[model samples]
Target: MKKIILSLIVFGATISLASAQILPAFQIGLKAGTNLSSLNSTASETFSGSNRAGYLVGVWTRFGAVGFNFQPEMYLTSKNVDVTSSSGGVTRAKFTSIDVPLLFGGKFGALGLGGRFYTGPVVSFAIDKNQSFDSAAGKVFSLNYQDQNFAWQFGTGLDIKRISVDLRYEAGITKQTYDGRQTRISLFNLSLAYSLVKL
Candidate 1:
């Protein structure tokens, strides 16, 4: 956790420095929302449908001419997934990650009527994991695990004044499981952020 804290501090300092240099509109924000997450595999087993509650808090700096700006942010996120068997059983999995995203987009109108598009990569560190299984025999089992992988996020959002809403798709690029099994996990996040300051 020390490394994550340090990285956040460094990222904050960098944003501060960039704001001082460019004198652009800088804003720090907090966002909280839900994530719809699931895992997809090439192997023909059907996956389960589960919804996870996730949130993010970050600092962002926007710079450039009117109608176009570049924004970068660092945030902490939580993701969850629950899988059920076709015959009616359930397994739950959860993950927490710290992510940094660099986004580029623009504003449309003075009243925040237009739409903005942004896409970027996210670097994440998994902090926790939990798995639970429900059997047909009325028995339950739980497992504790950890996943540390470098992931990627690319998606778009809409910015209106101090409030920005975003929908992002995230995918894991690194394999987290053993047994030489390669699996891919993906999620869709609907988030709302409030800008805190303008520099």
Candidate 2:
């Protein structure tokens, strides 16, 4: 009987210690942002495009340990390009894609309220209604774009209370053909994120 009582006491103590030590180092959040997007050419063909504005809205989860964290996010994003042809005609093409990024990073200064930096590869899947093209020559064309593409992202953010403000740049790693011309896309993103839960 005495051994049984002692064992119960030890178990209770262990449970209490675990509860005290294992606090929530994970956060879940929502983010919205804007993108300044453009295109570049690597082939012999010359491509000219103006910077276009796009939007992003997403959900993200981050797991942190010892001032470092891994963040993975999914978003509905807009990507676009506006090109001027040699005949002084302009074509505006827009794309919609689901973007997924897994970022590994470190935080500095304060634990929950500080600055962070991350770099990661992102993959995007094109959705239906992916492309809309309009030209100044009264021509409208819609083509099924490439289904998937990859990019590299570098970003920095500042966390204040439950809000984070971030700036990021993404560069394309593969060539995607647009209107029979080989080109790649890149963008600058500015975002604001809010923490919804931490447990």
TM-score each candidate: 0.69, 0.79
C-alpha RMSD of each candidate structure in angstroms: 13.0, 7.8
Residue-level lDDT tens digits of model 2 in 1-199: 9999999999998766444323338899999999998877653244467898999999999887666788999999998777655444566778889999989887765445788999999999988444444455544433225779899999999999789998999998767764567777899999999999976
Candidate 1 structure, TM-score to reference: 0.69
Model 2 lDDT-worst window of ten: 136-145
CA lDDT of each candidate? Answer: 0.63, 0.79
Which residue pairs clash in candidate 1? none
lDDT of 1 by residue, 3-112 (tens): 99999999998776554333345567777667776666553253344666666665566675545677777777777766554445676767777767677765454444
Worst 10-residue lDDT window, candidate 1: 137-146
lDDT of 1: 0.63
**Candidate 2 similarity to native, TM-score:** 0.79
